[model samples]
Target: MDWTGWIERWGEPGVLAVAGLLVGLGFGFFAQRSRFCLRGAVIEFWHGRFADKLAVWLLAFSSAVVLVQALVVAGGLDVSTARQLSARGSLSGALVGGLIFGVGMVLTRGCASRLLVLSAQGNLRALLSGLVFAVVAQAALGGVLAPLREAISGWWVVEGGPSRSLLALFGVGPWDGLAFGALWLVVAVFFAHHSGWGFWKWAGGIGTGVMVALAWFATYQVMSHSFEPVQIQGLTFSGPSAEWLMRVLSEPGKPWTFGLGLMPGVFLGSMLGAALGREFKVETFGPGYSLPRYVTGAVLMGFGSMLAGGCAVGAGMTGGAIFAVTAWLTLGGMWLGGGLADRLIDGRHA
Candidate 1:
C-alpha cells in the first residue's frame, strides 16, 4: 500500500480528503436509503416498539462494531492513535452533553447527521437547523461558549489509552469485543426480520455501518503511508461540522482533510440517494413545528455535541464500535435523555 504516488499526485491532505469523500458518499447514500435516524430509533424504543427504525439503527451500530473489531483482530487496523482512544476524556461532559444533545435531537426531529441527510433531500427545516447546528458547534469549539464547555469538561476527566478504552476497562480483548458485536448483530437480524423491512432498508443499514469501519480503516492507511503526521479518525459530525463551518468563514486556505471532504460528500451523496429514490422534495415549517422550537433544539445540539466530544453517529456508532469508554457513557446519556424528553414533551402533546 505505497501511498507515495498518491500523496505526490494529490498531497497528503488531498489524499485524506478523497478517502473521507469516498467513505462519506457510501455512508450518506446508505443512510438516506435506509432512513437511518437515531432520533427515530430512540423515540421508537421509548414508545415501546421494536420496529423498522430501531432495527435499522441496530443493524448499523452492530455492523460497525463487528467490522471494526474484526479489523483490529486481523491486524488490518489499529485505533491506538485515534483521538477517541488517545486523548484525555471527560466523563461529565460525555454524560451531560449527551443528555443535552438527546433532548435537542428530539425537539429538532433529527440528529446532526440525519438533519444533513434530510437537508440534502430538500427539507428546508432540516437545512435551517443544520446550519444553526454548525454555527453553534463552531461557537462551542472555540467561540464564546468554549469557556463554559471547558469548565464542564474539566469536572471529571479520564486519562487516555487504557482508561478510555472500554475493552481495557472490562478486561476484554478485541476477540471479546468481536463476539459482543456478533451477538448484537444477531439481535439486529432478528429485529430487522421481525420488522419485515425490504431489501434496501436492511442492506442500506448494514452499508452505513460498513462505511464507518471503512472510514477508520481508510484514515489509518492514509496516516501510515503519509510522510507527514495524519490523525487516524472515523466518521463524526461535531468536529467536522465545526471545522467545515470555520473553513467556510475563516480558514478557507486550511489544508484539505478527511473532515473537510466528509461534510460535502455526505450532502452530495444524500442528494444522489434522494434523487434515485424520488424522495427529493422541498419541505418547510408548518403546523406543529415552530421556529423557536427548532432554534432552541439546534442550540442545544450544537453545544451538547461539542461538550460531549461527538454527536450521535460520532460518539454512539463510530466510537462505540471501537469500545471507547467515554463514547459509551455519552451514548448512555443520549438514550436516557432522549427517553426522558420524549416522555415529558411528546407525551404531553399526545
Candidate 2:
C-alpha cells in the first residue's frame, strides 16, 4: 500500500481523529482484557507471583520492536520519529526517574497509565491521582521543578559517540535489529511457558504486545498523513496527560494535535470498555489514608515521568520495543524505586 499517497489524499483532521479513536479502542480493549500493567507486573515479579504479567510485558515490548522494524524496512514509518526511540542520553536519568516512578506507583497502588485505565473503570482515587499527576507533570515540565529537570538532563552526556540504536551500536546492519528483537521475543515466550502461566494467559500477553505495536503503526500512519504532519510519536502517558489539560483549557485556539486527541481518546475508549464489561467500580480515598499520600504519589510520578521523559507505557514498553537506551534506564529506575518503596513499607509494617 502506498501509505503516504493514501494519507495525503484523505488524511484530514476528521479522518485522523477517527484513526486516533480506533487506536484508543484497540489499546483499551487489549489492556483491559490482558490486565497489562508495567508497575503491577514488576510488583508481581518482585513477589514471585503473577510472573505471567512480566512475560506479557516483555512480549509486548518485543512485538513492538518487530512491528517498528518492519515499518522502517517497508518505508512506511521511521522509529526515530518517536521521541523515546531516539538514541539519547545514558542510563542515569531513566534509571533514577523509573525508580522514582515505580516507588510512587506502589505507594499509589498503580502506575500512571494504570491509573488512567482504572479511573475509566470508576476508581475515583485514580481520578484524583491522575489529576495530581497531570498538575505535577506540568509543573515539572514548565513549573517549579523545570529547572531541576533541565539541570540534571544537561549534566548527562552520551559518551563515546552520538546516540545510536542498539543495533547500530553492535555494528549490525538494519536486519540485525530485527534479528535481535526476535531473540527477545523468543526469550519472552520461552520464559512464559516455563513460568507455569497457562497457554491462554501467554497468548493474551502476546496479543497485548501486538496491540501496542498496532497503536504505534496507527498513530504514525495517521500523523504522517495528516494535513499537518508531526514528528512520529507513540503510546505514552505522562506528557500527554499534561498536554491534554492544556488543550482543554485552551480549546479551538490551541488547535488540537494528534497527541492531545489520542490521550483523551484512550481514556474514553477505556471507559466504554469498562461500561460494556460491567467492570466499572467507583472508588475513593478510604478512611485512614490521608490525602497527602495520594498527592505525594502523584507529584512524584509526575516529576519522575517528566525527568525520565516518558512513563512505563512510553519508556518501558514502547521505547524499549524500539531499543532506546533511555527506555531501559527508565525501566531500571522504576523497578529500583518500587523496590525501595516496598522495602520501606515492609519495614514500617514489621
Candidate 3:
C-alpha cells in the first residue's frame, strides 16, 4: 500500500520496471509450464475439437477477465486511464492486422509470446523467429514499415474513451462483465475436467491469467503513486518487443520502464521454468522446417502487431479482459484468420 519506500529507493521508472518484471516473470513461468498458447487453441477449434489446448486458453482468458472486472467493481482498480481505453484506436487496423497476425502465427507455429517462451527454452527456430519479429515490429513502429501501417490504420478511426470501451458500447456494467467472466470460468473448468487436465496444467493456466490482471493492477498502482506520469498497461508483447529492440540497438541509456524490464523478465522466467520442468534443450530447425516460412511469418507478425496495436496476449486476453472494443474486434479477426489459415495451409499439408 505504501509506495513511498519503493519510490524513494528506486524512483518512478525503477519501481515501474520492477513491477513489469514481476508480472512478466509470473506470466512467463506459468505460460511455459502450462503450455498456454492461442495458436494451439485456434488450431484445435479449426480442427473441430474441444481439447486441453482450448481449455488452457479459456482458463487463462476467463481468469484475467474475472479478476480484472472484480477489481474494477470493487473500486480496487481504475482502468480509465489505460491506453487501451483512453487512446485513439483503429477498427480497420485491428481487423486487418489481427488477420495477418493470425496467419503468421499459424505459419510460424507460435504466437509472439509463445515464440519468446520457446526461445528461452532453447529453441533456435523460435529464437530466430522472435528476432525477426522484433525487427519487423521495430520497422513497423517507426521504421520503413511505418508508412504502410499508418496508411492501413488510418482507414477507420475511433476516438478514445467510451468509444473504445466495449463495456460502455454494450451498456454493460462491471458486474455484468464479472458475471460473464464467471460463466466462462465455469466453461473452462468443465473443459479442463473433460480433458483430464492434471493440477499443474489447470493451475498454470490460471496463473498465466492472474499475471495479466496483476500487470494492470501493478501499472495502475505505479501510475497512481508516482509524481511522474506512467502508462497503465497489461501483458502485451508487441510494444515491449519494439521497445526492447530499440533499447538494445540505440538506447543503451534509455530510462528503465515497465516494458524494458518485462522482456528480459519473461526470458529469464521461461528459462527457469524450462530448467525446472527438464524441458530445456537446444533445438534447431529440422529438414522438415523451412527457414523461408519462418522468415515470412515473422515479417507478417511484426507488421500486423504494430498495425493492430497489440499481439495475441496483448490485445486478446489483456485488452479483452477489460472489454476494449478494438481488442475484441482484433480477437474476432484472429479467430477468423487462424481458422482460414489452418484450413488453407495446414489442412492441405495434412
Candidate 4:
C-alpha cells in the first residue's frame, strides 16, 4: 500500500498510540519475565557465573542488528536519514560518558529502563534513580554539562566523514554487518546452552533480545510511518527519559512522538505484569544508611546517563543493536565504571 493511503486509513496519532502500546507491552513483559537488565548482566559476568544475563543482552543486540537491516531492506528505511545515526564518531564523549553511566548503574543497582520498570513495582530506590536520571539528563542536555558535551563532540573526528555507525569505521557493508551480528548470536547461544542455568532462563534471555528487536521494528515501521511527515527512527535513552518529563508538563499542545508515548506505556505495562504475576511489592530503603546510598546512586546515574547520551537500555542495548559506534563506547564506559563501583562497594561492605 502507498504511504499516504496507509496513513489515511489508520490516522497517524491513533496508529502511533497503538504502536506505542504494543511496544510498551512487549518491553514490559520481557523485562518482567526475564529480569533482563544490563547492570545485573555485567554484575553476573564479573561474579563468573549467571553469565546468562550477559548472553541475553548480546542476544538482544544481535537481534536488533538483524531486524534493523531487514527493515532497511524491506521498508526502504535509511539509517543515514536519522540524526542519531549520523551523530556518530563521538568516541571521547562516549567513553567518558559511558564510564560515568556504568558506574552510576552499578551504584544505583539498575539502568535507566530498569529503574522505570522497577519503580512501577514500587521499588523506592528505582524511583529515586529515575527521578535523578531525569534531572541529570536534563542538566547534561542543556544545563551545566551541555558545554562539555559540545566541546567533546566538536573535537572528535570521523575518519570517513560521518556515516551510519561504527560499522563504517571498519568499512563494513550490509552483508558484513549481518555476519558480525550472527557472530554475536552464535556466541550468546553457545553461552546460554553451555551455562548451568535452566532452559527457562536461557530461553527468556533470547526472548528478551527478540522483544527488543521487535521494539525497533514497531518504532520504525509502525509508529514512524503513522506520522504525517514521518520522523527519523532510532532507539536510544539519554534524551528521551528527560523529554518524557517535559512532555508530561507540556501535554496540552505537544506533538506525540513515539519515544514519549512508548515510555509510559512500558511503565504501565510493567505495573500490570507485576500485578498479574503476583510479584508486586513495595520495596524501599531499609534504614538510615540505605536511603542515602540509594539517593546518591540515583543522582549519579542521572548525571551519568546524560553525559553518556543514554542509559544501558538506551545506548547499550538499543543503540548497540543498530551497531551505533557511540553505543559501543557507552557500553564499554558503563562496564568500566560499573566494575569499579562494584569493587568499591563490595570492599566497603566487606
Q: How much is 238 displaced in model 3, in angstroms?
A: 0.8
Q: What TM-scores do the predictions have? A: 0.98, 0.87, 0.98, 0.87
Q: lDDT tens digits, residues 248-285, model 4? A: 75657765666776777778878877887778898877
Clash pairs, model 4 backbone: 98-333, 99-333, 102-334, 133-302, 238-310
Write model 2 residue lDDT over 149-183, tens digit each, in one string. Answer: 87777666463232635555666544666777788
lDDT minimum window of 10 residues, candidate 3: 341-350
Runs in model 4 deviating more than 4 A are 1-6, 9-14, 73-76, 155-164, 197-200, 222-228, 287-289, 348-350
Q: Where does candidate 1 have its weakest 10-residue lDDT segment?
A: 245-254
Q: What is the C-alpha lDDT of each candidate?
A: 0.93, 0.72, 0.91, 0.69
Candidate 3 residue-wise lDDT, 1-350, digit = tens: 77867988899899889988888898899999999999999998878788888999999999999999999999888988888899999999999999999999988989999999999999999999999999999999999999999999999999999999988988888999999999999999999998895876799999999999999998888888888877888889999998888887784777888888888889988998999999999989889789999999899899988999899999999999999999999999888888888888878535
- Which residue segments of model 1 deviate by more than 4 Å? 348-350
- Give candidate 3's total backbone clashes: 0
Residue 292 in candidate 1, Cα distance off native in Å: 0.7
Best by lDDT: 1
The segments of candidate 3 whose C-alpha lies over 4 angstroms from its true place after superposition are 348-350
Query: What is the Å distance of residue 164 in model 4 from its true position?
Result: 5.4
Better of 1 and 4 by lDDT: 1
Give candidate 4's whole-model lDDT: 0.69
lDDT of 2: 0.72
